[model samples]
Target chain A: MAINKNSNGYIIIYTVVMVVIVGALLAFLATSLKGKQDANVLNEQKVSIMKAFGEADANFDGVVTMGRINGGEFTVVEKADQQAVFELLGNRKALGEATDNLPIFQMEKDGVVKYVLPIVGKGLWGDIWGYVSLQQTEDNIIITGIVMDHAGETPGLGAEIATAKVQDMFAGKALYDATGAFAVRMQKGGAKNEHQVDAITGGTKTCDGVNAMLETSIGKYESFLRGAEAEVEADTAAAEECTCGECCEEEIVEPINEEE
Target chain B: MKLSKNFTNPLAANNPVIVQILGICSALAVTVKLEPALVMGLSVTFVTAFSNLVMSLLRNGLPSRIRIIVQLVVIATLVIVVDQFLRAYMYDVSKQLSVYVGLIITNCIVMGRVEAFALGNKPWDSFVDGVANGLGYAFILVLVAFFREFFGSGSLLGFKILGDWYTPNALMLFPPMALIIIGCIIWVHRSINKDLQEK
Candidate 1:
């Protein structure tokens, strides 16, 4: 007796066989490639963050925790990225709210400690995020650089925000103005000052997204920034104040010869 | 020579994309870059050939009521496997192709061949037809991508073909431009095939 190919039983059996085969194939392939894919993703994150910080080749010593801007300012919840590091970027879930623990990337260059924070926000289509490094010298703190990327944005339009030229606009821009407000803005038409960067011309929604993302995400770390600045200032002042009366005597040693 | 028409007809006169105008969505999407277009073309060609083969083999057993469902399942599985393979091996190209690779399951070329030629034909004949249709689609996809990437991006694949003085046309990069380019190809094809013209 020949099997009936068009019977309901045959079709049902065929469907089950096909689904199981495809599912098994997909699962096996995905599982096998998961390690490589995760490595690729992790490498990409490192490259992008480093590029954003204007130091693509800078050796990432390791992840470091920045003391809260005011030692209890906002909580930066760890475990954000399944890694025990400072990827302190706020998303839709943590927006306008304090994070449990904000992760700051610390890099020591030329005796100065540079702090890089994570940025995460919503774009027109999907998630937009990047790393922004803050450089503090003897006096003030400024954005050393920023690098942003998006999961999905219109190519050549909204996606232009991820280009080197766009990210370069954030370098050396002050994190806050005289009023101590996080003042970085993606100004449409043209940006007039250091705190502003021109928005992508036909990519208004994405630019608006970057603007709000930076504003609020950076705003969430406001106290931390202020606290870091004050700490630096106090450090500089304390070293220069010379307030001890007991050891006021100065030693008059001969100046060392130069170029010996 | 007599058997060649099955493999050659779709290249021009019986083309799946231009003459029949069936699978235009994927054509518009993956044709923006030459590399992706090539990848997509290969992907389509592979899926069409394999799906056609599988459909022909199962055509006798398939219930008439659920033939379309069977065809879809075959095409979808083939496309997903291809997508996964691409992600694993061609990671960069996979990233660029993104959703368009998954969208291949919707490309009418695969299903169109199964419905038109595969069901009643021998596996070998159906495979030939599938390859021909796949080539036909690839032909149009490459042509569209050639013009789109060259004019729109001033480059082919990743190499710069045009001088810096040549400013790329932003419009050509748009999805509508793919349609326009396809329209132009159709116009040219029709001009050569006067029989295709309407009275």
Candidate 2:
């Protein structure tokens, strides 16, 4: 076979044609898979939140439903009075925005309304975010669930932080002391108290990062919490009628002020 | 046409990594984990075979002056197709493979086979040659990964093949081990096949 000595123009044309063909093909494939990719990400978020809350049968399949939280919707209630509903927040994608106007869920079960605050922070290799439901008093809080993910961390070490055993330790752990200061810490050696979490053996840096993240991330919500508490107090004082035992006791002494 | 010489030559005698010293970077990076190594090997095999076939088909029409450019364009196109297929169907594996999948474009074995064999041979022969060379590359990778994953983490493809008593050596997962293993493989392969010795 005689080898054809082709001109430079022919080579350039061939290269351009090949580039266009391949580029077009890849573009089509990427467009087709974009939906599936987004769904996978959403599913992963749900699975992380469920795992953090120690919920059973949490599959990372990205179908949104009322029963499943999936980082999309969540119910918040006050710790003081579990019966009161504070708020119901939906469409959580807006919660991660830079705006100060957070999507807060409020509901009234008994009489008090509580504020549900969402927190986001960075883990060792990726992002770790969670939602903390606080009572109107802003004293006691419950970690509804946490979602942790990593871009690329050492598997079995840093990645293990996403597992159930590590995340479950934060379920009822109080973020503040009686003095109302952030005292939440991950115990490096081992957790001595119920509030402390045991660190993974080889994930010391990751553990410390989680601790620092929670502190800084949760600290931002302090103002919103204080505002909610103040609202609750004002509501109680403004009520004309009181059906509670304390209010009934005050009713009996109403005539004594007139004699004085 | 005799098939034995074409098939066996690449497996050991003209092994790409040891003898030809091509495509060593991926062998080191992906070998740390068996799963990724397997995926990378399969991907290389697919890319090499098809690229060679395509190159062989166009060899007659390909201008001598731009042959190298044409070969690269063909190989790169195949690599992109493989990458897209992996991403679409096997998203998790694709993520784990990461940039290594894209790096397939630079893997020397594909380009070398195209220039050396595909450009000069018929399409059928080029395809076979591509497969043989890809298998040869994969053979070395699997061997290196077997030892690396076995001793590095006391696991095979993430399964605990070795019991708890066998303490894993962390150094095995490092890239240096791949170099040493490839060197040892070369030493053993050369010792057994005296004809492969450099003049």
Candidate 3:
């Protein structure tokens, strides 16, 4: 007898077989490519960090993950040395979960050690994130380099945040003033000082996202930087106190401001 | 000559976008950039051809009641595989293309061919028809993207052709303008093919 192609049993069997096969294949493909996709994200982050650290034309080489630091106004940890991506969590001071740990990448250029901080926040449509690198100055943290990128920003409008043209506006913009307030921003109209950059022609919302991300991400690093500054001062103090063998003393320096 | 007709008919007389107006949504979305338009066109070409071949191979066994589901499963699997391969190998392009690649599963053109041509034709012939229809769809998509990208973006394949002095027309980048362009193409196509005009 000729088989009834429309039989219920036949339809069910065909569906089950097809679903299992398709499900397995897609699962296998996603799992197999997960490693490569993770690597790509890491490499892209590296490029952004590197670009933020040196001249756009600089031939700077090498990228080191350095380590992760858990920081906020209330807590301080130095050189935590956590290396796993799964274990690493950098909260966008404004959006990330309260328990997230911040990841930092470090690179050296022209004898200057630059620390790169990755910032993530919202764009008009989706997530916008970037790397902001700071050069430790004698007194404060100076914004040396920045690279901004987005997930679903309008290609010609908000998406301009990712382009070198927009990111270049961030070069030399200081995240903190002489008194150390997070003052750097992506602002509209004409910029009067080093803290501002002109917003994209049609990307005002995205610019706002970039500004907010910097504020939250950079503010979280305030204490850590202050610690570094005190460490530098302590080094100076120790050297001066060690004049000859008669007097040698290590001065106690407050690592961070514990009061609000 | 008879075999060639299957390939040539869709390019002009039986065009998918202009004549049938089946896949206009993608034609509008992907045409904003020539680079994406080219990639989307090729991807659709692959989906259409391969899905048609597979459906035709199983046509005799396809349960009449469950044919649509079977066709959808086949088309969806193909689209996912293509999307994954793209993400792994052509990540930037894949990102730009984004959800549209998955939307190919819903692109009526793929479904239309499976139901219309593949359901009835020999496997080889169905494959040819699918490719022919894809090229037909692509021809219109690339045409729309060319005008949109050139006038709307002042560029071709992401390369700047217009001088710095040129101001891009934002209207061309908008989706409605794509409809207008497709409308004009349909008008021109119908004008040339007098037989296509309704009495």
Candidate 4:
């Protein structure tokens, strides 16, 4: 018996069967791939953090230390529990009520210690975020490198923030001004001082977002930054105060060579 | 001989982008860079080939009243699966292509092949036609993307070819430039193939 191809009953049955088969296929694929996708995302975060630290292809296993700021105190996170820190960054939002725990990563290379902070903020269209690498000098903290990304900023305009040209400008720029305010920003006309960088030509709003992102996110680590800065200053001051101490003893040997 | 004609016809004489003027939207959108455009091309090829094969195999049993809906369901499912696979395996390219992979469901080439050729042909013949049409579209996409990426960003496939002294043409990075390049391709293609020109 030939089936009636145009009958309503056949259409309904065909539709139901087709829908069920397609749905099951897609559901099965999504479930099977979820683990791999999650791993990719986590690896991407780790790579971004490494890139921001200016160490591409660097091993992340034992080199970087993960931590969080809780109750105005910084605490190191164990390696096993570090997955939660990455998840926290993935779910971060702009202007969400400041959470008790703020994620931070620390890495040391060539005797210089760098702090990598995960920051989230709003751009013209959607969420903007990045890892900012900061180093402490004798008096202040300066950005060493940064790697930014956006959910949906306009390409070539606001999205320029993600480009190396823009991010490279953050390097050597101090996070604090002489007045000691969180003064780093994207200057509109052109940056005139160390605290600013030139903003994208047509990306004023997104630059403003970056400015806010840097201020609020980095500002949350003020206590940690101040402590780090004080330690550096104290070390230099103590070195200068020594006349016959370890630092001066080395200098004295150098002076004797000059005299000879 | 018939299969060979089916395969070769779409490559140039009945090209999907230039001759048929189909799939211009994505051609413009993804052609700003070579990498994403190549991925888009391959993804479209995958969707069109499989969709054609499936539709052709099911053509006899498919009810005439719900043909379009069935085609859509098939195309949508294929596109989603491709998207999931991309996210899992090629995360960076998946991020770059972003929504265009999902938008393959709306690409006319996939549906057009299934409707115009697949439903009436043998599965093997339909599959060849699908691949040819997809590649025909891919050929134009890669050609346009080469010029765009080279001039627009002074690079090819993310590698900088021009030195610092060379300034990139900003206009080439936009969608309008893709259109202009495609228009130029059509002009050159028609000049060579006289019969394709409208009287």
Best by lDDT: 4
The list of candidate 3 runs beyond 4 A from truth reads A31-38, A55-65, A72-83, A86-95, A98-100, A137-140, A177-181, A189-193, A226-260
The numbered model that scores best in TM-score is 4
- Residue B58, candidate 3: alpha-carbon lDDT: 90
Q: What does TM-score give for chain A of every model?
A: 0.79, 0.61, 0.75, 0.83
Comparing candidate 1 with candidate 3, which one achieves the higher DockQ?
3
Fnat of candidates, each listed: 0.38, 0.38, 0.49, 0.72
What are the per-residue Cα lDDT tens digits for candidate 3 across A189-242?
Answer: 757677778886667898898888888777666667676765665566567665
TM-scores of the candidates are 0.83, 0.68, 0.83, 0.87
Clashing pairs in 2: A84-A109, A85-A107, A85-A109, A86-A106, A86-A107, A87-A105, A87-A106, A87-A107
A131, model 1: CA deviation in Å?
Answer: 2.5
Residue B84 error, candidate 4, Å = 2.1
What's model 4's lDDT at B16?
Answer: 94
> Model 3 residue B40 lDDT?
92
Candidate 4 TM-score over all chains jointly: 0.87
| Residues B37-118, model 4: lDDT tens digits | 9999999999999999999999999999999999999999999989999999999888778778999999999999999999
Winner by DockQ: 4
Give each candidate's interface RMSD in Å: 2.2, 3.0, 1.7, 1.4
lDDT of 1 at B108: 83
Could you give the CAPRI-style class of model 3?
medium
* Candidate with the larger TM-score of 3 and 4: 4
lDDT scores for all predictions?
0.76, 0.67, 0.77, 0.87
Question: In candidate 4, residue A80 scores what lDDT?
Answer: 88
**Residues A167-191, candidate 4, lDDT per residue (tens digit)?**
9999999887766778899999999
Which candidate model has the greater DockQ, 2 or 3? 3
